[model samples]
Target: MPAFAQDSDSETSNNTMKNTEYVTFYPSYGYQDEGLWRIPLRVWVHKHGGWGGKQLSKVAKRVVRNKAGLEELHQDQIEMFRFRFRDFVADSQSFEAIFLRFDQDPDEEVFRLQSADGDKRTNFNGLLFGELTLTFERAEELLTAQQSKNGWLRFTATGKDHQGEGAVRLIKPQGDSVISDIDDTVKITEITEGEAVVMMNTFFKPFQAVPQMKALYQTFDENVALHYVSGGPWQMYRPLADFLFKTAGFPPGSMHMKNVRLHLLEGETYGDFYRLIKLGSVASEQQKIRQISEIFSHFPQRGFTLIGDSGEHDPEVFAHIRNQFPEQVNAIIIRDVVNDATKNPERLQGMKVIQADSAFIDADG
Candidate 1:
């Protein structure tokens, strides 16, 4: 995996340290491979100037007005926007490595994260906007030092003078599992309602869980592992994570989301930032397929229940994955966001489709 750094890494490290910064350890999963434990550890490092000033809000409103729609944003919407957008406009940090402490005391042995391809330090694209994500391959004996009875472990990480904590869920080589989509399946995004509506729901409105969706997930016993794979960008991780595991009462699980980056753009204007959001947030079918396939390859003896929404390409993507791993995929459930799945059979030909207002869904076939 490539390294992640901010666009302004050329600036002095002292200057970067003076600025208010934050770090996020995205939830990841661990697996045993060839007598070793490996974690696809993902971390994001950046600086936030805080939301006390409206300068950031003004810029964000301009971007939303130009990109989301011509409608004027309410005061509440602007406040909501600032909460998530605070991390988006911040500068990413360039660090040689991050320190990791496993499920031991603070004085225990700490490990450093590094790439499998022999890059001693992490690399980051100096983009003007968007979140910076660092994914490292760590195959170490530290994890195996302590066995977990519940098949999960917790770890605290510190890097670039920022402190954050994350957890990893380990699945057995053979068991039943559920791979789910985030946007319209469990959370309401109104994706089929067009770009403006999608933006409003994503940035402006309060996040609401699909009726009884949390209860549906609760039905899965501790034996069945959970994975949330979404087309959303990693920048949305904080809000989404809280909404899922905290506010909405859904089970905690490993997350896999699209990387956030706008390449070489300066991102100084509203238009540029709008393009960053529009261009970078779109879902890549191949990306979803490849991510799910990696999970399947990791646990060939496991059975999976694929759950997604009909708003986008979940049906097609799930169908493709089912075809590729016929023995592993036991069922496919598609939440009908458009409310026309039965009318258009071809769209979800062989998959199971439920109504938009479905109060419950069965993952067990």
Candidate 2:
């Protein structure tokens, strides 16, 4: 997910509509075997009742920078962040209704769901998001056989108020999956750059990727499954997925991104173990450790090669998985984001995880 907010499936068109509505299937990945496979689908609703331009306050006009302004790049990034914040403040809302439709057929023919959980649906801005657990049995086998650019099948989610689509990528029982981070690994998110990271995300600017990382990914792209795991919010799922294909030239696979949840977001700040918690809500900011562990657990027979960066807790998280399921994880590649990458060259030398700087990617990775 570049810009990390760039979502190919999450957002609606840029609009000044008085009332905006949208739906999305976060993660864009699911799993099925020989039985009834249930995929969790979340539907986000945005209802706004004012001009889009009115969403931003007067202060933002002075804050958001012009293209040729001083410290242009940095200012643009800050402006992007402010733009997102303004959107969050203005259009972001919690809502629900009885007629939340999830179907794969364009004409509502092959697959459809009329009602979900008795229809007493509702949503909240932060904690109470709406969700539906889609179930399937023998039909799953038929779906597994179907093919498209992204995954096994494409699903359409339509509410009386809004409609959207997402790819339901499946996890196979007997195959290889390469699960890796997007930011700072495959793409140049510049996480360490702090506030300056937003510029690459705004206004259709071309986002960059890590050198040779694409080639490294392409090496396995032919005969393996690619799962993108990232810290980017699911709100940007659409453009993010789009960029992965057209810009990065990576094969289509399932996406696992952040869900904006207060506890999970604040846990890191409060030094709490919220990242370890993994139940209850259908949509919430799932900590990477718990989410990645779930993926490993989902396909015990499948071997996974974890790739992430030293920019955050990816090294620690991937290392933990490697230690726990050393056999399932084929390799752990950690790309250095900090300057002093060689401070402890001897550390983790005996393990399968390889920590190399960006310069050595194509040559070593």
How do the predictions measure up, each by TM-score?
0.80, 0.69
When summed lDDT is taken over every stretch of 10 residues in candidate 1, the lowest stretch is 1-10
**Model 2 misses residue 115 by how many Å?**
12
User: What is the alpha-carbon lDDT for the whole of candidate 2?
Assistant: 0.52
- Give RMSD (Å) of candidate 1 vs. truth: 6.5
lDDT against the true structure, per candidate, is 0.66, 0.52
Q: How many angstroms is residue 163 displaced in model 1 relative to the true structure, after the best TM-score fit?
A: 0.9
Evaluate residue 114 in candidate 1 and report its C-alpha lDDT on the 0 to 100 scale. 57
What stretches of model 1 exceed 4 Å from their correct place?
A: 1-21, 50-57, 66-74, 125-149, 263-283, 362-365
Q: Which lDDT tens digits does candidate 2 get at residues 1-365?
A: 11122223223344543333544444445556446454544444454334553434333333333321334445555544444433333354454552332333333443333234533344564122233333564335346444333335555544454554555555557678888888667777665653323333332245676766777777775547777777665544555665677667876766766644323222252122122111212232236777788777778898887877666666667777778888898777777656324675443343333344534444443
Q: Tell me how many clashing residue pairs each candidate has.
A: 4, 12
